[model samples]
Target: IKYLFINHYCTLDNLFDILLYTPQLCRVNVKYLCQLHDIILNEIPIILSNLAHITIEELDLPFDVFEIFIKKMTSKLQVLSIGIISMNFTYLDVNQWEQLISQHIPYLSKFHFEHYEKMPSLSNDHHNLLKQFTTFFWIKQQWFFEIHIDTQLNGVLKKLSIPFIHIGHVLNSSILSSQGIQLVISSVDERDHDILLNDYIKSIIISTNITCLTINSSMISCVLIELLEILHNLDSLTISYSSRLLKLHGCSQQSKHHNLSTTMNITKVNMCYVTKIEQVDFILKFCPHIQYSVQMILNYHH
Candidate 1:
């Protein structure tokens, strides 16, 4: 059979037998994905070693379902993509998530967390969960970890040591304050400019080894300046909001010279949603050895 479709009535034992015979199966999509929690608990050793790729649509799954699945599959599995079809926060608990990561999915190299019912909350449970996952071997290595939180996760992110971090929410000072983070992809939707002027931005400039930086249109001018100051090793920088550059009154000649002298190795810069041509000119003048690409958008988007 090219595919396998197991109904809710299928027992866990039957599912195990089906997986054993279909080692070459490329795509396995489950309907009520959470219902297989029992099967995973019983046949983790066998199921994880054979399964290749798993996609779950509805996310009403208990935290344990994921925990058991990841624990078993981390050693052999390669790609895991979970699509949360619901918005219910109760279905997934952050504490259980931590347990799953620390105890189970430490080896995953590529992880995608998408489409949750509600945004993730940064409670003790959430912090602990991310802490556990952040330290997973997958994250510790050079893997890409993407988190889509409707809420904030800086508190949790601060404690973890991951090479790359992508946050799709309004960031607080605590989120960007960490020094070891190498790559930051963020979307800022708020209008407040003062929050971006805090010491956190300065810290990111001086401390972070960030080489790839991507931000949405709502980013502030001061944030860009801070980024310019500390991007000593940055190779690729993508900005979704170009119009914000207009508000950057003027950089002191010394500051401009300092930025150029510091960012000697920058090669690629991506600018999106810029309304003024001057912004592009300004960046090109500062980074004379770099290449630039500009995209025009009617609205600021990331």
Candidate 2:
């Protein structure tokens, strides 16, 4: 097969077993790549010379295991996109990645890396993490990295990419179990702002049970309008306060016409950095069912 896609959970061994048969695979997309137990490998010559594109939605293995897999399975990888949900500090090793890419995927043109870790536990400062990603090799590859810290739920999100934007929920067990999963969606370039919401919603795994959402983008007002229309089950909403408070009314013209207050069953709204009372009032207009609010007015100077 020239193309292979696995949506179900597969161990590293099982993945290699499958690849053993498909030696001509040019593209592979795995939704969940994991290793539950000790993986014993049989020394077999596995060469996927045509494997140029690889995308792993969830990487649940150690970086060392991944390094071995990449070296053995791929040869001409042009695009590599992977997301990690682990506390392993080794995954953040910049030198390791530089060496791996240099030795294995020498002709790599694009790389998308996403790392999610529980905050307070992850003592590494975002600035230091950013500095680690801004090495000479990364600069040469033109892969800029951006770090986003979500303080409300104590989670840190860091993304490094060539020119791709990734949207996913922060990997938090406590928050996720309580149905308060938070998704941070942002575009790498401002030009893709128009289709950001639409593209993000489509990319995410369908789950209507998500009750909490935290938006970290500057276009929160308009994005909130889109969320209200789509995520009907969302109850708790959090957004950073921006200077474009008046844009709420202008952006919600559709909400004004349609009885949005009746359908928007959001019970809690958190404008954590509210600069004025008018912003709260405007939000309340859309979510009349909001029983709780955590708006803290601050002297937000531009």
Best by lDDT: 2
- Residue pair clashes in candidate 2: none
- Which digits, one per residue and each the tens of the lDDT, describe model 1 over residues 81-109? 66565533443343555456556555444
Candidate 2 — which residues are off by over 4 angstroms? 125-127, 150-302
Please write out the lDDT profile of model 2 over residues 204-223, one tens digit for every residue: 31332445555555554554
Q: Candidate 1's C-alpha lDDT? A: 0.46
Off by over 4 Å in 1: 1-26, 29-51, 56-67, 70-78, 82-142, 145-187, 199-208, 241-246, 251-264, 272-276, 288-302
User: Which candidate number maximizes TM-score?
Assistant: 2
Q: What is the lDDT of residue 89 in candidate 1?
A: 40
TM-score to native of every candidate shown? 0.49, 0.53
